[model samples]
Target: MVKMGVEEGEVMQHSMLTKSIERAQRKVEENNFGIRKRLLEYDDVMNSQRTVIYSKRKNALFGERLDVDLNNMIFDVAEEIVAEAKEQGNFEDFQIEVIRIFAITPEITAEEFAQGKIEGLTDRLFEQAINAYHHKIDAIGALTVPVLNNVYAERGQIVENVVIPFTDGIRGIQVSANLKKAIETNGKEVFKSFEKGIVLALIDEAWKEHLREMDDLKQSVQNAVYEQKDPIIIYKMEAFNLFKSMLAAMNKDVVSFIFKGEIPGQETTSLQARQVNQAPVKTIETKAELVSPTGVSEEDVNDGPKEPVRNENTVGRNDECPCGSGKKYKN
Candidate 1:
């Protein structure tokens, strides 16, 4: 070893313990660096996923072509339906699925489906599904636009932007759109906001869950080293799988919510109005009226005869009688 303060050409001898300690220190540093490098590689995987998710969220939040996105999703779902049915060679199942998802019966008959090519079937179903969805929106607009106009006329206010309520049974979100645009598009413009809200909500929820899963995965993958496997490689592969599964689930949920979601319609509004108009109004009781002359509230007094309380230590069915009968309690 060469001492820092030694002159040129001078060498200092160190004990064996000192050399061993220096080697251990260097080894510890290398181990730490390796750990850090592994961590960086893991984070790189997450960074890529984060970038993808945030990009989607941004598009949903501010993009102008959300209808195009929705159309693509609709087509993808339609394609999936057709492909599954084709794989199973079941036209009945295909028709059922189309009705279930799109609320429209397929125009193609069983024979036509049996003879149609996969690409042709997919395209045909996509066209039908998209058209049905548009018609459904137009029908809703037919109901909603009149109601909106009525309200605006009564209020004597100009219509600009309007907030529409959409629900997926469990979750409800309010989406805003330009009334003029919605009217021009026959309620398709309002659905753009619907798609935007649904996409954003699903993305946020799925991304949060994905993060938690990734955290668990990170901790769990640490044990891979004990199995004589490279932890980083396992983590990367598993993380990619997890990400793909997450994306698939998110997309499915978005499509399902969009198709199955309920918008408040004229019938619902009228039913609510009738219910409100017919509901009986009850008068609130005053505190003095609630109290009896005995200074106790009528509700506090039970009018019925009280039942006797049973003792907790009552004889069990198998216990000997307390009357000295030397028989079981049941007997």
Candidate 2:
């Protein structure tokens, strides 16, 4: 019985393979049009989100203006936090949340917040956040942009790479410096090489986690129909919420890592995603090569061989042959 069962399983596997191959053969015979259409229909929704994420990353990687980018992100985060807290009508919770996310305690006292309008309270919070950032930079003599260098031990030498952090959680590297000569040669490039690697690292890490969460969310949402709800509608709504949450989390993580995390050095590396360009290769076609064509390509058929050429230079059936043999076409 065991042997029989194993044989039956093998037969089923073979049958499945046979079907798959037959389908593939049909597709080829049709000129591979079926394959193209299938690819176009697959994972279209996910591709849109992917494009947006990649565009954000690309902008961060190549954008030159760090201050403007950082300022915008900081403002955006502040706006989100303020908006979230506005409904609660609790200034204290707002302050606490601000400090928790920005790592800067608001200087405004509770009494002052209570005495003032919400707009005033928010302005005060923004002021404190900006001041806190300025103060940190002032102390580090990084009143301008802060350049960072990564230090690592390599072959009895200290190697350094300059990393720059822009505001949008994208980082750039200038050049690597040799530790032995770094002190003697404090070139602009050396300082320029210093960047904020932590921001991009945090954003990328958070985004990846968000994608994983979304995948799980999607898989679990198929059960929504069992609850007497439309799964498609539920999935779309939940997916949107998930994306918004992911964006919020990314901003918060970027801020937290930038302010509190240690600068990435040779021990740490830049967080730029590697870009690759790939294209499908075309192969030489043979007479026997089958290609699947779609309905449009095969719909029209005027059977038999097409008309033969009868141009000005060509001989007609009743005219003499081109060879000038002086023979009629019938002859």
Shift in Å, residue 97, candidate 2? 2.4
How does candidate 1 score on lDDT?
0.76
Worst 10 residues of 2 by lDDT: 271-280
Give a tens-digit lDDT track for model 2, residues 34-63. 656544533454677678667666555655
Task: Estimate every model's Cα lDDT from 0 to 1.
Answer: 0.76, 0.55
Which pairs in model 1 have colliding backbones?
none
Candidate 2 lDDT (Cα, 0 to 1): 0.55
Runs of candidate 2 with Cα error greater than 4 angstroms are 1-42, 64-66, 115-120, 142-196, 227-229, 262-331
Model 2: residue 291 alpha-carbon error in angstroms: 64
> lDDT tens string, model 1, 182-282?
66676677677788888998999999999999999999999998999988899999999999889877776787788777775534353211111112243
Error of 1 at 305 (Å): 41
